[model samples]
Target: MPASPDRLPLALYRAAQVRALDARLIAAGTPGFELMQRAAQAAWRALRRRWPQAGELCVLAGRGNNAGDGYLIALLAQRAGWRVRVLAVGDPAQLVGDAARAHAEARAGRVRIEPWSECAPLSGVLVDALLGTGLSGPVREPFAQAIRLINASGLPVLAVDIPSGLCADSGRVLGEAVRAELTVTFVGLKLGLFSLDGPDRCGALRFADLQGAAPLPAGEPPAAWRLAGERLPTLAARPRNVHKGQLGHALVVGGDTGFGGAALLAAESALRGGAGLVSLATREEHVAAALARRPEVMARGVRSANQIQELAATADVLVLGPGCGQGAWARSLLGGLGALDKPQVWDADALNLLAAGALAAPRGRWLATPHPGEAARLLGCSTAEVQADRAAAALELARCLNAVVVLKGLGSLIASPDGTLHLCDHGHPAMAGAGLGDVLAGLLGALLAQGLEPEAAARLGVWLHARAGERLGGAGRGLAAADLIEDIRHLLEEHSPCLN
Candidate 1:
């Protein structure tokens, strides 16, 4: 969240592709060794800025250009009279091109380079330059041993480029990845760095445009663009003449007899997210408590389709299914609203009903907010399958359903029916609690009422929700659905929307 998503372009690159670009740069007049030196300087500068007083450098080196960067770092630290050691995991002589030159330079600078061992004392800041991004499959033998050692060392690590064992394309850890305190990536930003295991492995991220004056050839975007608060358009300040009706009425239809709390929360979130005249069409049972909780919301007790008709007809938006169970009553209620004309948000058991062929979305502009399990069921695939490539899965679902698909998970990818994909890279582990999806659905519904496009609403609302979760995630752990409403309002107000 520290870096705006817009700061990094939508383009992404694989390890081989970047490496090829590096070679092309060398071929295009920039000396390969000069690029290596520039990279080393960049890493060193970032390392110093991140940890100003940390004097020692424990550089983990492999036989590739990444290790070359580490070796050059060791040389710089050694020349600066700081304690520096190169824990070589592979044969340094096997290093070719600028990497070999770096190894020679490190040796020339009288820097200590020794064969790596698990027992090697890691006293200072660790530098992970071992596997790099070109690596795939399992981390074999020595490198694996080194990664295990680094993890056990519990040292604050500065990973060079992508983490040692992380895949730049998909972010699937290849066996294991270095847990870095700060990852300084170079040139083109790797899309995987912000998604999946990428987020967990990359602690504090910093990007450096190593290409300098040269620009590389463009390639197909990885899958989606990162969703940040900067991407949302500024909501004009409410007019002095603004009325509850003018802002757009959103009717929340859900909450069966037993699960009224879910419906209440959705209505509450809709109101908080700036929907004017938020109404709840729930069971007659929970009306009093919802009224007591937030009297601003019009709590309507509806038993049949006749009751929902007026609300649905008048409201600009409809948020369907929070605690709406897949029971006969829930189906009967939704079936009645099937022909109604309104921009809708379908979620939870409503998605389940869609999968079961019991419910059909009244098309125009709609959003479906589905967590992994719900998404799997909707796509007729296992959760693992949906997560393997979340970007692809989200895009497929959006295209098939002809609605904005918010496939929520670690990365929280949002895909539009027209093939635009955006990734919401915020949110914390604490958000894994129940009722969060319903909150997001309601938030998006409110955004729709506010007149943001369906895709923009999904992207902006999700980013705000995730930012709230992160802000509230303290060292104490665990978060409730209701815990985020205030933070959501604060973030929405402060989020300037348009990217600079």
Candidate 2:
């Protein structure tokens, strides 16, 4: 059986890396054609299981091995007494090597093959084999139109290998992409399948290693790691004698005006996320509400950035910019923290301040939680550019800022300055409401306060926060940011018990 999405491997490779591994497998005795045949068989099995009642199959065949896999599937469906047709998008005559052989075999099996056109009618389970990872630039001409047709068909589309036109390395849609109901990918799990546009395009992912799950060669490390069970980095279980003092303190700064809820949420999240002590330094107006909301937090009202000095002196880790507005007061608060080399989680308007050049970037140990918009500002590019290749944007941001970065969005990515990247594909769309980023920032700060390294904290914090959101977001929309705080606290305990 192919690996289900939830049961996928932790290691994530780029398209080039997976290809290299495929070559290695071929060099180690498995023929390329045999691998293609296995891919087809895996895809066929998954399709039958997913859509058992659907007896008809339409294969959109390209010119590469992806097409070879589709042709073989068509033959299998025909043999199984199901009506099957192959739409040769890339001319079958242009097929080479293994693909050519597969085409000939399909023809010998009496499978109907016809040239593709925009007018072609699509039905049943549409198999997308039009483009694969080899796609270099924007999809052009007939292929793009074919992808559009597949998307508009309202059919149960099953993409072989990957959804056509989705970049195998970046999850970026190249002009157009197939919206597959189920995608059967082979060999290694591509990083793109779990980042950016990948989750939306490749629905219900299934992985087939094709008996090539051998260890990768040296000097070809995975592009990133997927945050999941067993492999997810976590904090150690607390000792029986552990005390609040040993748990560490986290200070949250922000809540300019009319945004007091953001600061309170962060403070509350920090307390619930296992920080022994959490402080909130915000505008005087918000302090009364902050105290009323979270009595345990040491909420203080400060007029100037200098007032934060005493509070910063006590915090082991700081969460900067939850509801911080882009005003002079916000600037002063950020500037005031520059002298202290505290581990910090920078989010919201704090990121804006850094991007706008209102203040110098914070030095020392800091982690950035930037949604695509903030990331674009930091990169000096448009949000579309950042979304186009989130993995690249995350790495660049980490490298440029000299800090761990959590590029928040669909598939939240955590990237470290040393090129280490991890992705959490656990979030929900219902988490679209405000203050979620603030909660994430607070959770990250709590992890940091508790002594996890910046990268480790980022990976664990993102995973926990996303998982909590996923659990609570099952009821659909209207998931408040405060809703995740208690769930995250419970999950943190479940992940690392307070007394183990």
Candidate 3:
């Protein structure tokens, strides 16, 4: 696929939807057979480019047009003098329409077609052509066995469009889905390709518009947005005339007793992220430590809610629950602040509190950053349910909470109450260490205080957090939470809109 900026993004579709698209294209002018040939050529081009030295392609063929694409690819590879073989998982004689023609073409090109055997010589790249998007229930018998073999084969397997047995719309593996080394998709990008199990399954993605010698007409709008640095802009440089108050004050809430470090991290992140004033309302015990750590922050020892209410009253935004415990004390303080109508970000134990059914989402403009377990609590379901389809779960959280929901994970999904989705694919696994979510919540609160809309704030904050994590990747291991704020501040300067 040629890289182009104007191409339409992908939509998650069922096998039926893609078929409908193909039928529409055929009725519009192109023939069905021609489309099949185009899809085959596209897959072949991608395969060769990725595995330039590897030869002798073994295509796993099944029934339907997906199998037809495999056959055609085999023919194309043979023409290029690469030894190619097709192992039929289904009856080749039973194939009808365009697929039958493709099989005949492969035979003419001297491509060997044989019954699939567990002992078949595994060589070069394995092309998974067995199951196309029509799959519903878990993968059964033959296909399941085939998928297991493909995964264990250790060859660079290229899936035709979607990997066998993976749901095209949800990205869930039905029983099991082939983990492809590279996935070459045609027409629109699949929504499933960017979320849930999709990211891990679809290794490196490439797109091919077989119908377009140039570019296809802008198809249906993308089902979800793929957030990238190029699409989002950062904070503008302040004018010399600007004052501290004009920049916005952000309050860091929660640091009960032994957990003061979390609150201090949030305050420091807000300060580094451009909040005009950063206030830390934590336990009296940790006040001195916070002040000593970050002298710029207005760290205070709040014995009761009374002491912090004044700071909360004046705050432009509140970053709540970084290290909040679900104890009675934490609940009491949060209960008092719940109706303050401030643009607040709730994370960690605050999310757990909401999940425990103690506090509810506030009416104020808010951002809720929840990892899978916390999300499951708030939604009253198991974590596995949320991971099964992250896109839907995030959107549901946004609508139910009436706040921007940043469901944090591999491909962090930011969902708005209005149904807009932003997928963030940038982040390192080292970010899996503690306090990362706290850093994110603080960054989000900082953005809201700086005057971005809830959606914009959530989107850009996540990008900043992820980009910062990526920055730490070179250090190798032990990604401590406190290490990110300076890097995030640097990234903000690097990505600032006016600078660009």
Candidate 4:
């Protein structure tokens, strides 16, 4: 994900919303051509800052306002005494409205403009103005070839508004998309720029609300919100007289046979995440290890569903299915928990079992955290379908299960039963490993047990987990799952201090 500055807009809009806002700005007296000029200026400033020493420029121009921005940028470069060339990918004569006007301005300024050719030399910074947010279908012909050539050229690319051929709503690549080193977006923040393929294609994002567009009109709500520390819910300072019984007890149930560590990891995470008390119910063989590793948790060895009933009866929240296999033991544990009405955090094999129809979805306040593969299984779709529009998948999961859903991925999405969505743009690729999901499930359970609503708990837990992964991921690769627990605890205290 791009490094977000504190001043960037938090609301995420779809392509249509951004366009509507653009139209609104135009209606409010700012001419479309003027806005296009502002976009060009923004791109020019960002380009100069990023590549000040690169005096030569090459711009790939299309037929839309995006191309207009490119043309104006080329003119700006020419006026600045920098050698610049505009490669018109679309017919220059076919340019319409403000785009045509921009072409005329570039021509009047004696800016070098020529038809795109395969032999065009990609020099200095390459400006991608091929397609914009208006693109809806797969890229075709010369544009696709041009994007490929630019990518292959290994030049520092600056994209206008959004990278060409990327879906502005879904962040999906349309056949092919430009990979930009920096992207200068305009108006409202596009939803695609921070999710899915957006993060990979847009290296660093800079926003400029050209024309100083007013707040969105009534009834024009953002598609989702970017999760940030300032926007997240914080826990209140604890009372000095608080006792273990005052805070909720969290029970972690899993670890069938060979997967004892998964359950232990969850239990340990819950204990460290500020849960008043944490208890572990797993296979008998793992009890000694669990007790030795974390004596604070009341670890119990359970052999059957009947044995788990007593443990479940006393717990305030349940963290189920870390390393829980699809055998009889896992099924029995689910069945035992099914009779209770406590808040629950279900993950791993629990999600698998629910997808397989072996266990019913929980009826109480619950949060379901599933990766794309598991989400695909739960939704009865392919993983590609889930990744294509992760927000939709997450919303569907929340609606179907009537639970808060955390769709874990590059931009982790949290969907509420009310249809609201939030995206966590934190985390690092190095955190991709076994046991992270288990730790998240435990963290969610702890937050719930500490009295946060299901949605609040999911949001805070996901953010903490991803942010911790990002901090530890700086070391680059080989990040263990256990490495995140301490960071999460520390971050929680920092964000929601005990004495603040």
lDDT of each: 0.83, 0.89, 0.83, 0.91
C-alpha displacement of 346 in model 2, angstroms? 1.1
TM-score of 3: 0.93
Poorly placed runs, candidate 1 (over 4 Å): 1-28, 211-223, 303-310, 336-341, 474-478, 495-500
Candidate 4, residues 1-500, lDDT tens digits: the string is 22246567788988888888888888888899999999999999999999999999999999988999999999999999999999999989999999999999999999999999998778888999999998889999899999999889999999999999899988999999999999999998888888889988988888898857466678877888988897788988999998988779999999999999999999999988999999999999999999899999899988788788888999999999999898998998787585579999999999999999999988789999999999999999999999888888999999999999999988899999898999988999998899999999999999999999999999999999999999999999899999999999999999999885
The number of clashing residue pairs in each candidate reads 1, 0, 1, 0
Better of 2 and 3 by TM-score: 2
- Residue 358 error for model 1, in Å? 2.5
Q: Can you write out model 2's per-residue Cα lDDT over 1-500, one digit (the tens) per residue? A: 23324778777898988899999899899999999999999999999999999999999999999999999999999999998999999999899999999999999999999999888888889999888888869999889899988888899999998899999988888899999999999899888888777889999999889988555788778888888745656778888888888989999999998998999899999999889899999999998888887899999998776688888988889899999899988988778685588898899999999899887776898899999999999999999999888889999999999999999987789999989888887989899998899899999899999999899898889988999999998999999999999999988888887775
Candidate 1 Cα deviation (angstroms), residue 418: 3.1
Model 1 C-alpha lDDT per residue in residues 1-500, reported as the tens digit of each score: 12464465554555666677677787789898888888888889989998889999999999998999999999988887789999999899799988999999999999999988878788799999897777768889889888888888888899999888887866778888888888888866776787789977978887776755555556434455676555565666776676777778888988998898898889989999989889998888889988999899899888776667877888899899999899886787787565566788998988999888898876678889898888899899998877666777888999989999998888788898888888777788888788888788889888889888888788788889998999998644668898888789988888743223
What lDDT is obtained when candidate 1 is compared to the true structure? 0.83
Provide the global lDDT of candidate 3 against the true structure.
Answer: 0.83
Model 1 quality (TM-score): 0.89
- State in Å the error of residue 97, model 1: 2.9
Question: What does each candidate score in C-alpha RMSD?
Answer: 3.4, 1.9, 2.8, 1.9
Best TM-score goes to which candidate?
4
Measured on C-alpha atoms, candidate 2 has an lDDT of 0.89
Candidate 4 clashing pairs, residues 3+ apart or interchain:
none
Cα lDDT of model 3 by residue, 146-213, tens digit = 88999998889999888888887667888989999988876557767766687788787877656643
Q: Rank the candidates by lDDT, best first.
A: 4, 2, 3, 1
Best by lDDT: 4
**Order the candidates by TM-score, highest first — what do you get?**
4, 2, 3, 1
